[model samples]
Target: MELPIDHFRLLGVSPATDGQTVLRTLQQRLDRAPDQGFTHETLQARADLLRNSADLLSDDRHRTAYEAELTALSAEGEGGQSAIPALEIPNSKEVGGLLLLLEAGQAQEAFEKASRGLQPPQAPALGSSREADLALLAGLACQGAAEDYRQQRRYEAAARVLQQGLQLLQRMGQQPEQRRRLDLALEALLPYRVLDLLSRDLSASLERNEGLQLLEQLVRRRGGLEGESDAAFPASEFQPFFKQIRQFLTAQEQVDLFSRWAEAGSPLADFLASIALTASGFAQRKPERLQAAYGRLAGSGQAGVEPFLACQLLLLGQIEPAQALFEQGADPALRQWANEQGEEPLAGLCAYCRDWLEREVLPGFRDIEADPDLEAWFADRDVQAYVEQQDRKRARSAPLHPPEAAAGAGAGTPSTQSSLDAMPLWPGDPLASGLAAPSQPGQSGALSEPLQPEEDEDDWPDLALGWPNLHWQDLQLAERWAQLRTSAAELLAQPPSWVLPLAVAVTLGGVGVGGWLALRPKPERGQPIPVLPAPDGTVQTGAKPSPAATGAPKAAASPGAGAPGAPAPTPAPPAPRNLPLTVAKPSSAQLRSLLEAWLAAKAAVLAGATPEHPLEQLARSALVGNVESQRRENASRGESETVTAEVRDFSVTSQTPQRIEAEVTLRYSDARKDANGKLIASTPEGERRNTYVFARDGQTWHLAAFRASR
Candidate 1:
């Protein structure tokens, strides 16, 4: 019987290859076949075909005869005009019609037809490599669209496009090679997406937490900084990225997050511990944190340690020596920073260093909790908003021109079914950067008739993955650095008296407020800051309310570590009615009382106080379990918080006879103290939207499941 896919092509070996090589190749393929997410029948069929091909190719006499048949089959196949000569094209006009459009360089039309064909009624029209080919076409179409989004800096949209394609391909897992192609393209977005998240404004704790969580997930998947050597999309350098993002987070927040990671001995232990110590040293004005940081980096010889050490030295107001050390390193960012200093030297670099640590250094690192009124100040002159608005317009724009209409050299050329076959795969940048391989004679459409790919040792091209498919870029990182430097220069121009011993006046610290609220809708603040209703039922706008009025256990009264300027507030959630909720009028007072009681209990526990009488009875076992976990964590860290939970805007969405679903705006103010009872960190507030499923046990309502919004 004639082979459906030629044995040499299936094994991806030259016809002159020997039996030993064929067997070795077959074994390798069989080993990898199981993990490709193929269907059971497909796997079985593939296994049989692979074994048969190897058997037929192994014997010298049989191989000679097989090669003869393959040569004759090739001649017949060429007359048929099929690109993938190894595999028979399925007898379906639906598939043939789409392939023709793809060959014509109309990727969008090919993709649309393929998409419609994949639906229930049309999927039956496809089989074998042709089915996989259709899926590959759809994936490549997504890649083309994503590359456009990347150039426009619409990172989220680009990610969405890739993710949507991945979802579709994942469901059709029979074709492993095609699915793998899309996977690699999506992975390329890791750095760009993470950078965007880090650079975005810190408007809400929930938003910040979500970004941090997403970033961490990506890092963990890539095996963090240390283990990404073999990763398809290796992690971006974190030390400098962290340094850039740290300005948005408070010292307490930094310590709270990083210190926990360090203490837990996470994969990111050493670096995170160093950051925690650095932030703590400034927060507490304790030299011990610096000593520890020095110990962590001094002999570790980790990448970027020099820059980190230089930063520590700069923090100590060691100007000349630190500058020398910074310039010594191969860090592009530091070198550029030094060069920019020549333009506006900022009192000869001391101004920038002084602004960073004037409020630090020496002693008296008391938590003054200055807010800087960035909300009002940034609002008055929202330059970032204008720039971002322009960016949004650009992101939503149509392509500058249709796909490049070049031919000979094949730069930025699209390979559709109707188009000529591409040259052997280029080992350069994947499809996204429009980096074309050295052009050869024949070509095929990238998203439509991708078949008979050249499995080049350096670059795998089984499908016609055309230009404008990969989305990797420096992503204006240098531009961001320049912007920061410019901002620092402007800050130094004003505030002449900020120098205290080191000319450091702390331009922006502890608060990770990003460039602009208007860059994306996620961080925009359109509404007035929601006011928490006083525990006694009245709204508390200015003065700190009594324990009863603030929904705290009266016994845990402590000084409110207030902000110097008005506190930065989180936006309240949409009113309950605007949400798709089953609105029911439940006793508002009853829900409030239940929530306050739970908060009082929680605060008491964080303060290292015994849970008030009936604390166990006050909440459901699940809620109690979460509280106990928090208590144990704080205790392990030798720290505790005197927390005051102020709940407001409680809206009951849907309620059952045994339970109630509600959303409330909660502002949690904590004066975190170490085991010594000394106030080491007082962040003033951490607020988020709290969703509660208040499950009632017996007659009384109890806190059951609670989720803080991301």
Candidate 2:
């Protein structure tokens, strides 16, 4: 068995290598190789493999595995070399047949046949170096094609070819040039459209200047900045791109062309944020010098500078008018930042003010309740909805373009399959529409047809459940909870009507509520006692009134103290010094009347017949408990709501009158996930509990304060 040094060596180093080094080395080696019919194309292909492998090494884990393979191959020596396979080319006719299929716009069929019919490995030629070189070359070609496809906006096609490329490159030794090409391709294709789309979806209140700033950055990265030849694609062809961006610009766009020499770093233009501030300043100062400031800011590419200006406006509390100017400012990037912050560029400044309130301002008011309305204003749903609607409107107006056209028309070029094998051609911008445009007379037929993937919508890929997957789990839990609610409602309604009455009677037979003395049929021995409700949730009897039943202001006896039927205490409290003289003793008939009134109130409240009774408080408290538990369940699964609590001071004289104040807090949590199942490292998580505390106000308990922190 011949040792496969090429295979072992390919797997030994990083996937990326210096492209020039790999290309020159392969050319020299190919020149010395025996003329067993190896062509220059074969050598070129092997060099591509090295480059492709080098690119793969960028991913740490893949690099590690590949390196390990090299170690294993080197250690196995001859025995391991036997495992190396040889590859054979298909018949010329078969290759031609596949090429024809590809030219006919049947990419899927051509790929399938080519993959199935390809030859397996054989013993290495010249210690298997030739075989290894061939494998590496094939890999590089596939990788290069994949990348090219991606650049042309043929994502699906790119993915397919890239998979093939990766497999091939794994077998071939790492080539340097191929890796560089792949990197370039990936960089070119990485979608910047997401920023544009997301920005357009933000609130209208965001300064146009902000949006313009963002668009400028995006355009600059793509080499589309001002003074750069915007002429690469005719203005007519790129009208949609310009239109999509124009929303961020105010009517004050400078049609006046001023030539500026290109230099390194960010392009100098007045950022959108500054433009917004200038507009706002003009609105306020209405000064003759406004134009110069506006012009200066609009031409500079410094995005960060405008926020400082916006902050100055915010500090003067010129919020609404300043916001209007900002909203109309020309900068998409600035707009995106403002949109995310839920305000204009001065949001950080405003936040500083809010922080002061919590850190500085609030300390002074610790004893006094903060106004609840202030917090509620921020949670206004209508404002959020309006902003979302504005964003959608902007996106709807953006232009949609098709990906690049296919190759293989009478341009004197070979069929698409051959070209692909040589240098992969990509679908242009138009192809991204998922509907490739019909080929023009001189265009390639492969670019003419549209593709419809066959996979079902219900088919979800398997994924590893990591911390990042928690958001998904939260969603799943919510769906489950909804289903559970439906089933529970159905079950609750299924029972016979009379059954509820019987069940309630049995469960509540011994339970007591209010005065315990009312529940007791007769006085037991010498002391009076109150009845306690059943531990299990159920209906209960009301407690009795004291012997002095006038209902005037009375100091109630300590509960559970020296009462009949209670656990005996070895020690007792000091005896009462003065018994009340001429106290109105309660009559049996009066006691019966009071008990009847209490029962009636409880019954009416539970039936939802009326309110404004003592029993209503008890009912509301129970409802709170139920809702609290549900919220806890939801929190565990990673769903929450944004809530704010308000504290109020109240003095209610009705029913057990007491003067008091309390706090109320509300909160919510929503599930979130990243595009990939990786940790959404950007999102922050915190406590999910919401609490409301009430203090006594005269005879009643009123909410004093509420709080929610996430």
Each prediction's total of clashing residue pairs, residues at least 3 apart in sequence or on different chains, is: 31, 91
Candidate 2, residues 1-710, lDDT tens digits: the string is 12112321432332355445445544554354323243454445444444444454545676567667756755676664544422222342333333323333344444444444434544244334444444434444455456455556565466556556544444443444554565455433333332233234435435334444444554555454333444444434333454344333332332111111122322322332233333333333322223334334434433333333332333322244234444544255334323322222344234322322222121211012232121232233442233223222221222111122223233553333211011101123342223434543543223223433232223423312212332433343344334323322332211111000010111111221111112112311112221221111222235433211211111111212232453332232233222111113322222222222322343233223452335323222333343345345535655432211111111211111211111111111123233343333221221122222232322333222222211
Best-matching candidate per TM-score: 1
Per-residue lDDT tens digits for candidate 1, residues 551-644, read 3221222234233463633333433212111224336556655566567667787667765434565565534654677678889999877766
**Deviation of model 2 at 681, angstroms:** 35
Candidate 2 TM-score, true structure as reference: 0.21
lDDT value for candidate 2? Answer: 0.32
Residue 702 displacement (Å), model 1: 74
* TM-score, one value per model: 0.29, 0.21
lDDT of 1 at 33: 58
Candidate 2, which segments miss by more than 4 Å at Cα?
Answer: 1-87, 97-607, 613-689, 693-710
Q: lDDT values of the candidates?
A: 0.47, 0.32
